[model samples]
Target: MEKQKELVFITVIGQDRKGVVASISGYLYRKDVNIVDINQRIMTDGYFVMSMAVDAKAATVSMTEMSRELDQVGRELGMQVQIQHENVFRMMHRI
Candidate 1:
C-alpha cells in the first residue's frame, strides 16, 4: 500500500512585495517539503495572500520546527505565516 501523505496548510499574509513566493518555496524545497498545490493573489487593499497545500511526510524536520523556521522567514519578509495540519484546518473551518 502507498504511504499516506501528511498534508498541511500554510497561509501567508502581508503587504505585497517581490520574492515572497520564491523565498517561501525555496525554503520548503530545501527542507524536503513537497508543495502539492498553491494559490496566491493580491487583495483590493494591496495585501498579498497565499495558501499552500504541502506534503510534509518526507520533511527532514518536525511540523513544530518548520513552523518556527517559517515564522522567522515571515518576520524577515514582513509577513505573517502559519502552518496547520490539514485535519485541524478543516475542523477549525467547519460550521
Candidate 2:
C-alpha cells in the first residue's frame, strides 16, 4: 500500500536574476521535498516567474515552516513566493 503524496504548488515572481532556481531547488532538496514539475520564464518586462509542483509528504519540514523559509528566500531575491496545497491551487484556478 502506498500513502498518497502530499503536494504543494510553489510560485515565485520578481525581477530576473542569477541563482533563482538553484537556490530554491537546493533548499527543497535539503528538506526532502521532491519537485514533480517546474515551469519558469522571463517575461518581456524582464520579470522572472517560476512555478513548481512538489511532493512534500516526505519532507522533514512542515508546510508552515517551509512557507516562512521561502518567504525569507523571496525577500532575499526581491521576489514574491507563494505555496499552496495542490487541491487549493486547482480550486482557485478552476473555471
Clashes of each: 0, 0
* RMSD of every prediction: 1.8, 1.6
Global fold similarity of model 2 (TM-score): 0.88
Could you give candidate 1's per-residue lDDT for residues 1-95 as a string of tens digits? 76699899999999988888899999999999999999999989888899999999889989999999999999999999999888986788886
Clashes of 2: 0
Candidate 1, pairs of clashing residues: none
Please list the C-alpha lDDT of all candidates, in the order they appear.
0.93, 0.92
Q: In candidate 2, which residue ranges exceed 4 Å CA deviation?
A: 44-46
What stretches of model 1 exceed 4 Å from their correct place?
A: 1-3, 92-95
